[model samples]
Target: MFDCIIVGAGPAGSTAAYHLSNQGRSVLLLEKKSFPRYKPCGGGVSPAIQQWFDFDLTPVVDNKVNRVRFTWKKGDPVETELDTTEPFWMVQRDVFDNFLVEKAVEAGSELQDNSEVTAVQISNDIASVTTSKGKFDARYLIAADGASGAMANWLGFKEAKQFLGAVLEVETAVAPAERNTAKFEFGSLKNGLLWCFPKSNGYSLSAGIIRGGKGKVKDLEKQLTNYASELGINLSQSQFYNYPMNLWSSERQLHQNNALLVGETAGIADPLIAEGIRPAILSGVKAAEAIVKALAGDRNALAGYTDTINSEIGSDLVLAQRLSGLFFQFPGIAYRVGVKRPYAGKMMSRILCGELRYADITDMAMQRLKSSLIPGRG
Candidate 1:
């Protein structure tokens, strides 16, 4: 029997396995897909994740984006140059995830690729996981199988509110001048934002509604294609992929009995930008820490997981949810006041780079707006 059986080999699962194994816990990491499999993502990661890993990630980093261009309805763009000290890094998820799984293996975690988890059950103090390869029993189970994973449903965790985001990753030569820049387009859709991110060879262009709805998938595809055409690039032959972006909610349970949910399964992604890497990794580490404490005679360790997440990650997500509603509901005001304002754009870039939090910047933007509205108050 393993001390911990983790489902999924993505960033969250792999990070949990690595940390657990490093502490001498017997960890079994399972993945539904083989290594280096393509994952649909904008692939933008802030440098803040550097604090989680000890090794250099230069191998997987495809580009360092020092500039960001924000546009509203394909109108005049507001561009901002990021701080020289810290810039956003982009990577192909396939390469980056494989690298992380390799690190988990190096840390003594047993990885089983192509092993799809079929069922998960927790009885008393033990968890039983049934996978395609075989059955495994462990003291604890960590679910990092992403938004569509069934482990959460099988284990009876409260359903999280999910948002759908789509991406079209294509390989085409990009000019040197445009290679290191990232672009975000607002007001293009009624309920979503569009993005074009630079990759090593080409770009990943995507569009999706922040709050998901049916019948918009095809519209997102058309929007992406039209946007690409405006930039003089054709995505007719490019590979297209779509995935759900799960946003965190206080009502969702993080741990139930001996089973714990992490990553997108737990809905920890940023609601505003739909970014998942930072929250996913942070949740993984925190989950491991909780399991470690639970093993060390603290029976209530798992119970505190939700509280910890609420304090650290949830507060920011709550603010992001509010900001998302405000921005998307009033895109024109957001564009004119927030995006067009130099200070606001700089703060936004800082938030994107993980230099600042959404709560901080939201307050700053509100203060700026107040100052602009009432001149004598300043």
Candidate 2:
């Protein structure tokens, strides 16, 4: 039996594998898909993730965008250069995920790609997974299989509510100006937003109803098409995908028995921008630490993981949730008062890059938004 079995090879799972193996624990990482697989994402990652490991991640980062351009319904742009210690990173998920998993393997963690897990259970206090490849046993299990994965259900955690998110990716040559700027458009999707981040060889355009309620796939695709058209991109050579995602809604028990949840499976996606990579990696790092402690007879380690995430990440996201509600409800007004200011725009970028916290600026932002709604201030 392995010390830990990590489901899914996304940032969370691979990160756990690397750390656990580095600490001399046996880790087995199972992935449903082969290496270099694509996922529907905007591919925007905070460069702040560099603190997690000593290995070089520069080779996998496709682009680093310093400039940000925000628009309201494809017009009235508020553009500025992000003033953070490091620029935002743009990556292709396939490349980035594979690179991390490879690092884990290099660190003595075992990886079994294309091994789709069909069943999971806890028997005799050992967590076991029955995959298409076969059954594997572990002292601990990390459910990092993402929002759509069934590991949460198998582990008996009341699943988080999810909404459909869509992405349209296109491969084409881009000018240097476009490559260096990350783009966002508000008021194009109801209660949601559309974002485009550059990849080394292409662009991934993502849209989702992040605040609340469900979204029709057709509606998201249509809006993305229109947004692409407005950006002068050709639709004939693009691929579109739809996936379900869960954002942080409430604090819940993330640990059960010897099993724990991480990444999207743990409902850690950012409520405002739906940022996933940094949070997923952060959860993975913490999960590995908690499991290592548990293996050493730390009785409260797993529960502490839950508490740490709830307080550190969930608390911040709660602020983000409130801000997201206010921002999405009145996109036009928020764009004018909150985002249009050059400093505010840069601060938003800083938040995304992990340099700033919502708690740092949300109070002022809330007052600004609330005041703008008064009389003729807007």
Candidate 3:
């Protein structure tokens, strides 16, 4: 039996495998899809994630964006140029995930791709996983499977709240000027927002309904095509993809017996911005740490993983949820009063980059926007 078995080779699973293997533990990394498989994502990630690994990650980054442009219904643009030491990184999920897995392999973890897990059971402190390829056993198991995956339910966790999100990938050559800018368009759809991020050769345009609406979540074709037209882009070469976003809705236990949930299976995506990769990586590292402790005879180590996540990142999501409700409700007013301010965009970017916290501005922002809508509630 391996020391640990990690399901799903996304950012979370690969990260856990890397850290665990580097610490001299045997790890088995499993992926349902083949290497370099395409994923529907915006591909924007924080540079702050470099702190988790000791290796250089520049080889996997496609572009570094330092400018943020915001618009309302594809008009009235407000731009912010970040002055931080490291700009946000844009990556293709296929290359990025494969690179992470390669790092784990180099660190002594075994990777098994195109192996779908058919069954999983934990009994007597042992995890028995049966996949399409074969059956495996491990001392501990991590369910890093995504939002649509069944690992969480099989392990007996509550169903995480899922929201609709869509993406359009256009592969036309991009101008150098547009390659460094990340654009966000507000007020284009009901209970949602749209964003377009630049890659080295092309762009990823995406949309999502953030504040709990099921009305037109799946009807994103109209929203994205119209937005693309406004930006003077042709959609003839665009590849459309949609997926469910499992945002971090509430704090809950992340461990059961010798199994733990990471990435979307844990419902750890950001509710406000729909950022998944950064937090996913964070959970992976923390889960590895907990399992290592469990092997060393810490009875409460697995439970500690849940507490660490709640205190370190989950609390901020609560503030993000509050802000999301008010912002999407009065997006126009919030845009004019909040997103247009000189320092507003910078603060939001800093929060996504892990350099700032929602606590620093959520109260002030909610009060400001609430007063704008209510007229006399100060």
Off by over 4 Å in 2: 376-378
Tens digits of per-residue lDDT, candidate 2, 1-378, equal 999999999999999999999999999999999997988789999999999998989998889999999999899998989899989999989889999999999999999999999999997879999999999999999999999999999999996989779999988877777989999999989999999988777788999898767789999999998888898876677999999888886787999999999999999998889998999999999999999999999989999999999998889998998999999988899998988887898899899889999999999999999999999765
What would the TM-scores of all predictions be?
0.95, 0.98, 0.98
Q: Write the per-residue lDDT of candidate 1 for residues 231-294, one digit (tens) a residue.
A: 7775656987778777764545688889889999999988778888988988999999999999
lDDT of 3 by residue, 220-269 (tens): 87888888889888777898888888887678889998999999899888
Name the lDDT of candidate 2: 0.92
Once fitted onto the true fold, the runs of candidate 1 whose alpha carbons sit more than 4 angstroms away are 212-215, 249-251, 367-378
Would you list the C-alpha lDDT of every candidate in the order shown? 0.84, 0.92, 0.90
Give per-candidate clash totals: 0, 0, 0
Error of 1 at 184 (Å): 0.3
lDDT of 3 at 249: 65
Weakest ten-residue segment in model 2 by summed lDDT: 228-237
Angstrom error at residue 25, model 2: 0.3
